[model samples]
Each structure stands twice: as C-alpha cells, then as structure tokens.
Target chain A: MRMPVVRTIIGVLSLVSVIVTVILGLFITPPDVVQGNLARLLYVHPPVAWVAYLAYGVTSLASGLYLWKPTRSMRWDQIAASSAEVGVVFTALTLVTGSIWGRPAWGVWWTWDARLTTTAILLVLYLGYLALRRVQVSREKRAKRSAIAALIAFIDVPIVHESVNWWRTLHQGATVASIGTNSKIHGIMAWTLLLGFIAFTLVYVWMVILRYEVTVTEDAIEALNISAWTLERENEIGSLSDEIAGLLSDNKDRTGTSSSKVR
Target chain B: MISESIAVAIKDLRVERRSKVGLNQVLPFSLVVVLLFGFSLNTQSRVLTTIAPGLFWVAITFSSLYLISRTMRLERENGALDGLFLLGISSVSIFIGKLLALLLTIFVLEVIQIAAVVILFSVHFESIALICISTILATVGIGTVGLIYGSLASDDRLGESLVPLLVLPILAPIIIAATNCWSDALGNHGGLGDPWLVLLTVFAIVFLTVGVSSFGAILED
Candidate 1:
C-alpha cells in the first residue's frame, strides 16, 4: 500500500495532465460567447472547489470511522488529518480563484453570494479543525475530540448553505451572479472541465499519499526519539546507583562500621 | 438520568451564583457593546431600531462566548471535571446539565438585552409572542452549540480564541435565522412567515442531538 513508485508515477501523470489541462483550457478552448476568456477560469475554479469538498468529505468520513468503536485506528486519524490539510489548501485556492473570477463578472471583489459566503465559512471551519489538531494532548484524546468536531462541522455545512441562501434571497432579491456553473456548458468547454476535474483529482490523490507517508514517518521518528531518551535516562540512573554504592563502601571502610547501621 | 442532569445543573447554577461572573462581568460587557453600537452608528432612532435585531444577536453571541468559557473554567479549575468523572456520573447528564444552566443564563442575558434595546433605542416589537418564541429557540441553539465547542476547547492552551472560531461559523445559521425572525416579528418586511422560526428550531434540535450524543466521547480524557 505504501508504493512510492506508484505514487511517483501518479504524481508525474498528474503534473502532465494538469499542464495539458491548463494549456487546453486557456489557449485551445474557444472563448465563451458571453464572458469571453474569463470563462476559462471556470476550468480551474470548480475542479479545485470540488476537490476541496471531496477532501473535506473524506476527512469527515475517516473521522467518523475513527470514532466508531469497531473501526477505530490511528490510521483513520492520520487519514483525517492529512485529508483536512489538503482540503484547507484547496479551499484557500478556491476562495482566491473564486474572488478573482468574481471581480470581473460581478463587478465586485467579493459579494455576499450564498455559495461564496458558505465556502468562506467552510474554509474557516476546517482551519479551526486544523488548529484543534495542533493542541497538545494524548493521541487518543485529540483524535476523539477532533472526530466529534469534524462530524459537527460536517453536519453544519448544509445548514450553513441553506441559511446563507435564505439570507441572500431576503436581502439581494434575485441578483444574478454566475457562481461558475451554468446549464449551457457543452462541447470542448465541457471536455476541458472534465479533464480539469480528473487532473485535479489525481493531484489530490498524489498529495494525500505523500502527506500520509510523511505523517507516518514523523510518528515513527517521534516514537524512536522517546524510546532513545528513555534508554539514555536508564543508563544514567544505573551509573549513578553504582557511584552511590561506591561512596557507601568508602564510608564503611573509613568508619570501620557496618553499612547496615548507617542504612 | 434526569435527577443527575438536574443535580449537575443545580451545581453549575450554584457555582455561578457564588462567582457572580455572568451577572457582573458578562452582562455589563453586553450592555457596553449595545451602547458602543449606538455610539458607533450615531444615527436616528429609526436607524437604531432598524439594526436592533443584528446588534442584539451580535451582543448575545459575544457574551455567550464569555459565558461558555466561564462555565467551562468552573469545571477545569481544581480538577473539578475529573471529580465529575470520578463520581461515575454519565457524561450525557453532565452535558444536559451544563446545557440547561447555560440556556438559563443566556435567557437572562437576552432578557436584559431586550430591555436595553427597547429602552435605549426606543424600539417597539409588534409581536411579543413571535419574539419570545424566536429568542427561546435561538438561545437553546446557541447554548447547545456553545457547550459542545466549549468542551472541545476547554483543555486547549488557545481555548478562549479557538472556541469562538469554532462556534461562530457553525452558529452563522442560527444568527441569520434568528435575526430574520426578529425582523419579521418587528414587522420590518411584513413578516416572512414561519420558515425562519423553523430553521431556528431545526438548528436547536440538531445541535442538541449532537451535544447529547457526543458529549461522552468529547469529555473522555
């Protein structure tokens, strides 16, 4: 399962696919009839957002499995942490790209549109999840606490979306701002988008594998360091005890008395 | 279980009574926020009334942050939380107990806030019944979610900051729904008709279930 060769192959393939995707999406694809070249951002933005969502979904699912009694393991915790880190990165990218795309389309750098606002909140929620993991605690305690937090956050997402949507409707009242998706997307644009999705998903897979490997290695190093420190402490204690015994013998010899009486 | 829950709630209320932290500190902080909002806006009475719903909820939200930290601090100090575990009481009871106590405390805070808003801003609520229902549901929702995050962050070094970060984003729906419900009750936009209240109710139910079910796991050391 820890196939570095396979991971490298996937990583290289992802790079190639992404490069091809960028070229096809930006240069080769025909411009949209309405939004001009800005429509090309559609190729990059949605896939990245999709990957962010996918990553968070995986994180929450792994966390839930870890919390369940029958399936609990350190592996699930590792998966949850690594996936969430990747998810956070992609979410940040999603916001940046979405803002860039929005500025020209919406005539504003940021709008309180439902999807955009919810995504911003999503970023904060997972960022908080990452911060929760950094709190110093026992592994089981950290995992257990974060698993529940993750589940709660996941459950809140749809509700967050719903409330934001309702609030947007009440305030804005039918303001038309295209948030990436449209029913009219077809032909080469659709193909490019599909490629974008595939390529980005591959990138996600590659990143998660490498990140998980790094986590496992780091855990091993920490374990080894702890054991080595304990061994060194034991050796120091052994030598100190010998020195004390020697001192006691010297006292006995000098005093010409039983050591038992001193004890 | 009910007795245990009530006992824990009483213990928390008794502790709060002795400490007076909520009464003296948090309540005054909220009133100050209300006053600060008025000063910052420096607008007409109508404008103050217009934004009163948002101001009231924002004040409640911030003060709830204070309330949760104080309540959790009571458990953290002197290993009192460990004492609870040692007593072999169920974590569900502990959760409900703390939740009930928080709910009551927040209710009182909201009441004072409502009074302040009505007095200082000269605002009149057209529908007291709807306002009461929305306030009760929203308070329960906030209390439930607040306690969950409070327990989650209680042991962290950066807990005070982290709890608000975790709680606020999740509480966004409650804040929105409650604000809209308040607007409706105040006849701001001729009453949007029951959906906002339903949303608030749903939020309360979801978090209540989540808190009750997961409290044991989160409280495990």
Candidate 2:
C-alpha cells in the first residue's frame, strides 16, 4: 500500500524535474565561450557521472552494512543489488555520454584521460560484481560474496584515479575535455547543471525503489514456489503409502489360508 | 596460525612440484607472450625499447590470469577447499598460505620475464634497485588480490572467464605504477620521485590486509 503511493509520488516528481531540467539545459542555458553549443553536454554528462558514482557509493555502503553482523538483513542485500543494477546502467551512460562529449570537444572519440579511464574501470568493476551475482548459489552466499567484491572494487576507485593522473602527468599531455568544476561556470549554466544533478538523482532514487520492489516480489514468489513443491511431494508420498497398504490388504484377503496357518 | 599457513604453503608447493603445471604451462605462456610481442613489433627499431615497459607489464598481467585460475583450480579439484574448511583451519591461514605460494610463483615468473625482456628487447636498466623493489611490491599486491578474486570466481560456473573481469580492473593502479616505475628505471622519462613506488607499497599492504580479513567471509558456505 505504502509502496505504491511512495512510488507514485516519486514517479510524478521525477517526471516533472526531468522535463524542467531538459528545458533549462537545452534552451535556457547559454553556451560556453570556447566550446559553444558543445558545452551544453556538460549539463547531462557530469550529472549522470555524479549519479553513477552516487549509486555505486550507495551499493558499497549497503553491502558493508549487510556484511556487518549487527545490521545484516535481506533489506540491505536488496538495496545493494538494486543500486548496483542502477549504478551499472548509469555507469554505461556516463561512458557513452563522456565519449559523445569528447568527440566534439576533444576532436576524438576517446582519449585515455584520468577521469575517462577511471570511469571506464568503474564500469568494468561493477559489471564484474553484477556477473558474480548471477552465479547459482544460495542467497546468503551470494550476498556475502558480492558484498566483499563490492568493497574490494570500491577500494580501487581512488587508486585508479591517482594512477591515471600519475600516468597522464608523466606523459605531459594536455587534458582536452576540461569537465572539472574549477572552470568558471556562472549564471544560467550553473543553475542548469545543478538542476540536472537534482533531476538525475531523483531519477536514480525512483528507479532503485521500483527495482527493489520487483526483487522483493521475485523473492516472495520463489519462496512460495519452493513451499508448494514441498507440499506436493509430501502428498505424493502419502498416496504412495496408501496404495501399498491397499495392495497388502488385497493380498491378505486372497491368501486367507496363509493367515490361518500363521495362527 | 603461522604453522598452519606454512603447512598449507608447503602443501601447495608440493602439489605444484608433483604436477609441474606452473612450470610446464604458465611459465611457457608468459614466455610466449613476450615472444609474440617481439614478433608483432619491429624488434630492430628503437620503438621496442620505448614500448618495452608497457609490454612487459601487459605480459605479467595476462600471465597472472592463468596463474590465478590454476591456483584456484587446484583447490577446486576433489573438493579440496571444502575439506580444508571442514578441517576447522582458520581461513586467514589458508589465505596467507595461498598468498605466499602465489607470491613465490609469480616472483619466479617475473624473474624469467625480466630475463626474457632483457635478452629480447635489449632494455638498458638505469636503476636496478627501483625495478626490483617495485617488482616485489607489485607482485605481492597482485598475488594477494588475485588469490581473493580467484576464490570468488571459482565458485561461479563461469570459472576462469570471470577472473580477468574481476582482477584486471582492480589491478589498474598496480599496472600503471609498475609500468611508470619501469619507465623511470629505463631512463625513458625523468625521475618523478618515489610516489609510484609508495603507491605500490600502500596498495600491497591494503590488499594483503583486506584479503586476510575477508577470507573467512568469502570462503564460508
């Protein structure tokens, strides 16, 4: 009951925010001094990257909580799985948008920049996490394995960033796509970026909630099916014994002389 | 715990000796990669020296996939992992033992790789000490993390195919640091202090600790 209402509210809020974000990002915001129209991608690309990172961060936190003894629950596992699934999607979007933005800005489809490389690695790491979850195992084992994998992968994030930075600095190559916040973004552009972040975050929240609900329903159906199968098997066993007892009685009736001899 | 770890390590070494899989299979695989690189690239050109560091690390990384999978496969055979758990041995000891064995095997593989690189690529070493230290730290880091991921992936039906997906991304830092450190040692680039080496050491310690502490959680049913 509560789920449907909350989901409805989130659905309405997300739709409104997304529409507003698109309008401001595409029409109202002014182009950059240098990048001009291509800079408009800044609104969507950075915010999607932010949400992707945010989703993975949530997954790591939920996984850590699930691994800890006091806070262990199926709720945490569900959240971890839900957020990871969403995180992988957003991560793929981040890579694709980053590539799209790079084509116009950097004059190439891809460059091994620190942020791009790190984001690509993040995508792979979480994809591996998702793949690990698909193994046919008991629920508890899957949860534990995935939680540890998430933590291990999370630890690599900072290292990947630092290493790529070190590599780039060593080569002394100029970073073409300057997406960092240090750039002088002002007025309508800044507002649109902020709105983009808010809208995407809302979208992520809405998606995760719906996905979690589906996971819960799937788990319930699986449990109900297992119990139904068990009940059916028990009934079959009972009927089998009844048939054996009937056959024994029929044989006893046919061989009444044997009963008298035994007496 | 220390004795148990030693016992496990010795047991793994003995198994490797009897089977000779690491020697006959993984080492040759590493050599073949180096040879393939030599063949694909113009060995006569100076470009070989310039790209040698990257090539060397790539070979090591690829070979690690085979070694990790082999290590995990040895345990998977005959349900040996379950037997180890049923023995009530500390999971940390098992992890440490596997880490030790992998480190030793990888170090040997690295030594051979270095020899092969020098003979084939004609790399002139500027600083032997830096290269050796980085190799040791990076090997430890790779070994510890590889063992953990190997165990995790071995449980899955995908088996060896899942290992690289789990490992290579996590190993990005080590590979980068190692390649840069080697570049610096070869005098291809100016010295950038010891930051990469420090990163390697830090990552090695962090991974070793994580692997040790989390082994029990991952290994249990």
Candidate 3:
C-alpha cells in the first residue's frame, strides 16, 4: 500500500520534472556562443551520464551489501539487479544522446575518446551482467553470480578510464567547473542543467522502484508455485496412505479370520 | 599457502599433461587465429605491422578465455571441485594454483605467438625488458580475472557462452595498456611504456586481491 503510493508520487514527480526540464531546455535557455543550439545537449547528455553512473554505483553498493554477511538478503540482490537493469538502459541513453550531440559538435558519430570508450565498455559489462542473471539457474546462484560480476566490473572502471586517458583524451573536461557564482556558464543555462540533473535522477529513482517491484513479484510467483507444488505432493501422499489403510481394513473384513489384515 | 598453491598448480598441470588439450587444441587454434588476422588484413599491407601488437594480444585474450573456461569446466565435469573443497585447502590457494597453471600454459602459447608475429608481420622487438614485464603483468591480470569468471560461469548448462560476454569488457584495460606497451617495445610508437606498465601492475595487484578475497564466496553454493 505505502510502496505503491510512494511509487505513484515519485512517478508523478519524475514525469512533471522531465516535462519542465524539456520545456525550459528547449525554449527558456539561450544557446551557447560556440556550440550554438548544439549546446542544448549540455542538459540531456550529462544528466543521463550522471544517472547511468549513479545507477551503477547503487548496483555495486547494493551488490556489496548482498555479498556481505549479516546483511545478506535477497532484497539487496533484487535491488542490485533492478539497478543494473536500469543502469543498462540509462547507459544506452547516454551513448545515444552523446552520439546525437557528437555528430553535430565533434563531426563524428563516435570517437575513441576516453569517456566514450569507457561508457561503451560499461554498457557491454552490465549487459553481460544482465545476461548472467537470465541464465537458467536457482535463484540463489543467479544472484551470487551477477552480484560478483558487478563488483568485479566496478573494480575495472577506474583502471579502464585511466588507461584510456593515458592512451588519449579528446573529450572536453568538466564543463560546469562550478555551478554557482563561479560557474563557467552564467545565467539560466546553469540552472537548466541543474534541473536536468534533478529530473533524470528522479526518473532513475522512479524506474528502479518499479523494476524492483517487478523482480519482487517474479520472486513471489516462483515461491507461490513451489509452495503450491509441495502442497499438491503432500496431498497425494496423504491420500495414498489412506487408500492403503482402507485396503487393509477391507481385506480383514472379507477374511473375518485373518489377523493383521492378511499379513 | 605457497606450497598449497604449488600443489594445486601441479595437480592441474598433471591433468593437462594427461589430457594434452591445451597443447594440442588451444595452441593451434590461437595460432590459426593469428594467421587468420594476417589473411584478413594482408601481410603486404603496412597496417598489419601497426596493428600487430593488437592482434597478438587479441589472440592471447581469446586463449585466456578458452583455457580458463576449459580448466574450470574440467573441475566441474568430474565433481572434483567440491571434493577438493572438502580437503581443507584455502580457496585462495586453489585460485593461485589454477592461476599459476593458466599463466604457465599461456606463457608457452605466447612464446609461439610472439615468434609467429615476428615472422609473419615482420615486426621488431627492441625493448626486451618492457615486453617481458608487460606480458607477465598483463597475463597475470587476465588469468586472475578470467579464473574468477570461469569459476562463476562454469556450470554445465550456459557457462561456455556466457564467459566471453562477461569477461571481455572488464579486460579492456589490459587490451589498451598492453597493446600500447607492446607498441613501444615493437617500435611502433614512442616509448611511453612506463605508464602502461603501471596500469598493468596496478590491475594485476588489484584483481589478484579481489580474486583471492572473493574466491571462497564465488565458489560457494
């Protein structure tokens, strides 16, 4: 009851914020000096990238919690899976929006820039995580396997970024620099960017909650099926024993002189 | 711990000796891969020389994947993995031992690969120390992480196909760093080998620790 209400509220808030963000970003904010209207990607791309990283961070943390003793539970596993799933989607979005922006700005659909390369690798890593989750196995095995995969991938992230950076870096470094009085971007643009972050973060939170409910429901259905099957098996055994007892009694009555039901 | 690891490594090596699978099958397969690269991108093409390091490492990476999965599946096929657990050896020892055997086998395979590349692509190797150290560090990193994934995915049903998908992306650093380091050694580029070496060493240390610490959990039912 409470969960759905919270989900509803979050869903509504996310929808409204996203709508407002789009309106403001498209209409209210002015264009950049160099990038011109291309700067509009400033709002969409970074926030999506942030959400993607945010989602993966939650995944690794939740996975660690699941792997940790005393706090280990399927709940954490579910959260990790939910977050990874959402993270994968947002990661794809990051690449798409970034690519869309890059085509006009960078003059290519893609480049092997450090950030771009790392993000591409990240998308594949989590896609693998999701694939591992879908393999037919017991619930416990799938959770443990995918959780370990997530943490291992987490360890690779920084190394990948640094190695690629050393190899080459063509992408611009840190656009915001600062958000407030000392910001690189001055007026409504910065605020629109800020709004973008808020809106997408809200969207992430809402989606994860919904994904979590789906996983929980799937788990509950599995449990229900198992419980139902066990009950059915128990009933079959119970009726089989009753039939055996009845057969023994009928045999005794027919014989009338037999002891212990013809034994 | 060292003795236990050695014992486990010897045990796996003995199994490989009797089987001779890596020697007879995987080595030839990887060599053919190197050859395929040459055929696909003409040896007469100067670009092949430039990408020779990348090709060599790509073959090695595939070999790592194959050997890792095969070794783990060998354990599972015989029910020996669980039985070995009952012997009271540390999972870390098992991990190190398997990793050692993997590195030894891959080292042999890489020797052939290096020669193949040198002859086929006509590349030179001047910085012997850089080549040696980078190969060792990168192989160790690859072997450790590959073993972990192999163990995780070694179930009889879906593991074979799942390993490459899971391990490839995480291995991006090794691919990039090792290729760059070798590029320097092969004289394809200026010597910025130190930074790549640092990345490999750091990766090797970090992943070795991660594998050793988590092996028990990963192997648990």
- DockQ of each model against the real complex? 0.82, 0.73, 0.81
lDDT of 2 by residue, A145-235 (tens): 8999999988989988888986773222322234354457766787778788888999999999999999999889988999999999999
Local lDDT at A32 for model 3: 87
Looking at model 1, give its docking quality level: high
Query: Per-residue lDDT for B1-221 in model 3, tens only?
Result: 89989999999999999999998999999999999998888666578888999999999999878898887888788788887788878888899999999999999999999999988888888788889899999999889889999988888668678999988998999999899899888884535347888899999999999999888888878
TM-score for chain A in each prediction: 0.91, 0.90, 0.90
Q: Give the Å error, residue B12, model 1.
A: 0.9
Candidate 3 chain B: minimum summed lDDT over ten consecutive residues — where?
A: B186-195
Off by over 4 Å in 2: A169-183, A242-263, B42-45, B86-88, B188-193
Candidate 1 lDDT, B52-154, residue by residue in tens: 9999999999999999877887888899988998998899999999998989999999999999999998888887878999899999999999899998988
Kindly provide the TM-score obtained by chain B of candidate 2 when compared with the true chain B: 0.94
Clash pairs for candidate 3? none
Tell me the TM-score that candidate 2 gets on chain A alone.
Answer: 0.90
- Candidate 2 structure quality by residue, lDDT tens digits, B62-140: 8888888888888888899888888877899899888888888888899999999988898999888888898899899
lDDT of 3 by residue, A21-93 (tens): 8998999998888889998888999999999999999999999998887888999999999999999999999
lDDT of each: 0.89, 0.86, 0.90
Please state the error at residue B48 of candidate 2 in Å: 2.3
- For model 1, residues A1-263, the per-residue Cα lDDT tens digits are 55799899999999999999999998999998999999999899889989999999999999999988999999999999999999999999999998898889888878888988889999999999999888877778888988898999999999999999988832233211232455577768888888998999999999998999998898889789989999999999999999999999898787776655687
Question: Which of the two candidates, 1 or 3, achieves a greater lDDT against the reference?
Answer: 3
Interface RMSD of 1: 0.9
